[model samples]
Target: MVFKKFTNGCVNLVNKYLPDAFLFAIVLTIIVFLAGMGITQQTPMAMVKHWGTGFWSLLSFSMQMVLVLVLGTAMAKAPVFERLLTAIAMSAKTPGRAVVITAVVATVACWLNWGFGLIIGVLIAKEMAKRVKGVDYRLLIATGYAGMIVWHGGISGSIPLQIASGSAESLAQQTAGALTAQVPTSETIFAPFNLIICLLFLIFLPLVAHAMMPTKENTVTVDPRIFEEPPAPPAHKFTPAENFERNRVMWIITLALGYIYIVYNLVTTNFNLGLNIVNMIFLFVGLTLHGNLRRYIDALMASASTAGGIILQFPFYAGIMGMMTGVSAATGTSLAQVISNAFVSIATPVTFPLFTYLSAGIVNLFVPSGGGQWAVQGPIMMPAGVALGVKPAVTAMGIAWGDAWTNMIQPFWALPALGIAGLSARDIMGYCVIVLIMGGIITSAVFLLFGGMGWF
Candidate 1:
């Protein structure tokens, strides 16, 4: 009861202060601008230039993220996907059970693929909210978002995969020759320490979610009516164009081509599953499962609205990344480098991973994309850790875990889930802040205890 009260208070406080996500991005931009000037040698105009230059940096990444949410939501709207999600959601008999189950499912899903997990988690929460009366819809969604806490330690984690698959020449260049060879998954994602952290999150997060549930009077349930699928348009005799839209022949040919390339790529490239491939798989699978171009188009149109926040907000974050990584003429260091360097300066061989984890979490606030964050911090931290006697894998995973850790409060990654749940960042972030604190403790402790020991 005391814990619930505390959780409620946290939620209330966030609800009071956290603005709309777009506004939050603006606020962060202002903070980064001010901090850049105050800490670095850059003039105000230079800071603005940095922001402007960086604003468009994520255009390619922005599109990919858009599709991650859009396609995932579209796929979820397909009858088969909807039925599967409903069945899973129906397993939760009570409000408390609903939050617990959503948390577990989201965590597991995130472990497999963060993008896949993000959509699945919130979709499941939305489904549960429809069926499970009295469930706190905000808490349910937040529980889903909490699953991201383990993402960097998961199988599809970018940092782990990057180090494990990076070409020796490219990695050597990125890490300043500190990492000339690939760091296998066994040394990072599947490492004992990393596994322990993922397992702990999988175990305790559901309990945390259960404890955070608001009381009956305070619980904010979703209106199931809001989720009702719209009726399809009336059938009509078709012209050639219309027939093409509705026909399975075209879709079959498209799917065949897509699957053929997918198989060829898997066989030839040793199953390299990057973001583009993930999006392609989602696109083809969604198209196949929906059974016709018209139905898939309808589903895509229905889910397209959810991409608004991502479209509106990501560039500002890209600019924030710009400010964070833009080097100051006077100090010769970017804000991100300054932050990373501070942690490195304090680290010994034993504490390197812990410090790296801590620093990455901090940097992630400004640059939320895992790949972007790595581009900024990896070059700096990797070599530093290697010099301190820490294994390259340990250092890399520290950065990975760090990037994933603070995502709880970072609204960037939450956009997709927020869009799916029809909630603002403020609505769920309060609970996520709670998850952030506890998860930080869990990951920090794991890194401190065993991160430097090199399980590989």
Candidate 2:
């Protein structure tokens, strides 16, 4: 009873103060520590390996934090681009149209990077909300939160691509070729198709939702003044000539592209310059470009400050992943047998993806990290998929679709969006429930169709 009370108290405290990532970390740590204690008595070597894996996983996450911060800061400071985005968002005619536009914008933002997508999606939704009247806060929240779903399908998602290509290393090997083939293909095909589908759903969804709840009215209005004030031209701190002389943006872009090129080359060529050496190069370039030595010190400190939460949380996630992986490995065959048995009971081919989707959704509630879930589920599903004569990629897509669709209602990723928009998850769940249902159907159908065509 006392332990239960203590746990509950901790949960309430975390819910009040920390972000979901941090909260997840805290809970994960407690669970891992207890589990480790139990397992160490029987398998010390396995326990050691798990801890080691957790440590490396934490380091990888820290590196990801550094990358996210750099990209986020640069994007935020690019006033010209930000204003352009705002103008485009404000151009939508109705509140419903604005919501649809927000979804498309969110999808595009996620294509760049998940962190950028989440941040910018919130900003766009907030901008739209301010201009729109009688707007359902739920609708705004839905639009903002839906951005997370698109992240897995986006160009930079890495999760699905990693699974599709076998692993991160393999994906990196054919980076240039894959970039040439996949990027353009994604742009020409999936991107426009996704946009049109989202728009169509947006148009039809409210009508269906209205039918279900007949008493509720579609009550969203737009203010003319919101669109009347054209944004002032960006203040160029440097004149055109001065800007040309400074060349800060150009330098940054060049450095970024150079880093990507080097990384791609090293991976593709199977060269071993060492990841640490590459990181050092990035650190040196970032420090030098941000400013002189003194300013570099300031930048590092600022970056470190923002990275603290992520740094702490990542290890806990690693530990949880370690535990999950350990469990799966120990009972993998038995689990696979059970899943296979269940599969036999299902009636149709559609049942396979549907089952995987539902399982993914359930697991996502507990393990919101896409990479972590993939690590746990990939091995289990891949073998089953092979045995069943289903392409592994199709199974992977099923996982991704399920993971993405439920993110609409999951508070894990919603916290940041909520903070930025100044709304609770509850405020959003009302409308998002509709989107979730529609998205689920659409995603399942897409997977099934692609699976049949071997496109997945």
- Among the numbered candidates, top lDDT falls to 1
Give one digit per residue, the lDDT tens place, for model 1 in 1-456: 888888988999999998999999999999999999998878999999999999998999989999999999888888998899989988989998999999999999999888888888998989999999999989888998889888888988998898888899989888878888988898888888889999999999999998888888998886899899777679777899988898888888989999999888878866766788888889989998899998899889888998999999999999999999999999899999999999999899888888999899999999998999889998999999878888888889889988998899999999988888888999999999889989989988887777455442
When summed lDDT is taken over every stretch of 10 residues in candidate 1, the lowest stretch is 447-456
Identify the runs in model 2 with alpha carbons over 4 angstroms from their true place.
1-56, 62-70, 111-116, 130-138, 157-160, 163-312, 328-350, 412-434, 445-456
lDDT of 1 at 258: 95
Displacement of residue 301 (Cα, Å) in model 1 is 1.3
lDDT of each: 0.89, 0.53
Model 2 scores what on Cα lDDT? 0.53
- TM-score of every model? 0.97, 0.59
Off by over 4 Å in 1: 451-456
Please give the lDDT score at residue 19 for candidate 2: 43
| Most TM-score-accurate candidate | 1
